[model samples]
Target: FVSEAFRVFDSMPEKNLVSWKAMIMGYARNGFCREALKLMYRMEAEGFEVDDYIFATILSTCGDIQLNEADSSATCYLETS
Candidate 1:
């Protein structure tokens, strides 16, 4: 499913931040937190500037799954980056 989304995204003529955010959020919502975080890191490493909505979605995912570690990591990521 994620691979399909990435395929579509790759085909897009102009990939925007919203597109990336949507993909990341979709992954997180589907219990793919590791993929979500990995993609987020990849995006950052590629110099994409993430916005508030991205952070909010990740935090929400952590809360939804009761992952304290993820929540703390998200909070720390937000604070530091």
Candidate 2:
């Protein structure tokens, strides 16, 4: 579960940009659009410098967040091992 990943993330003594991106992408890819967006804002609040990857990753998920509930349930349930 991504919750497990977050545990590790939370414990990090330091987080670089890639760490933020990985967590954001995990939340996004797991259909947690709001979480990803919130994390993006949190990343900004933490004073990390933004790059093209940040914009691209968050921008790519705009449509995901806009989906109606029905469409979201049907379209965004990705299974993982």
User: What would the TM-score be for candidate 2 when compared with the true structure?
Assistant: 0.69
Which numbered prediction scores highest in lDDT against the true structure? 1
lDDT of 1 at 72: 67
* lDDT for 51 (candidate 2): 60
User: Any residue pairs clashing in model 2, and if so which?
Assistant: none
Q: Against the true structure, whose TM-score is highest?
A: 1
Give a tens-digit lDDT track for model 1, residues 1-81.
877987887688876788888888988887777677777877777779877777777767756554554666666777798
| Local distance difference test, each candidate | 0.75, 0.68
Tell me the deviation in Å of residue 46 in model 1.
1.0
Off by over 4 Å in 2: 65-81
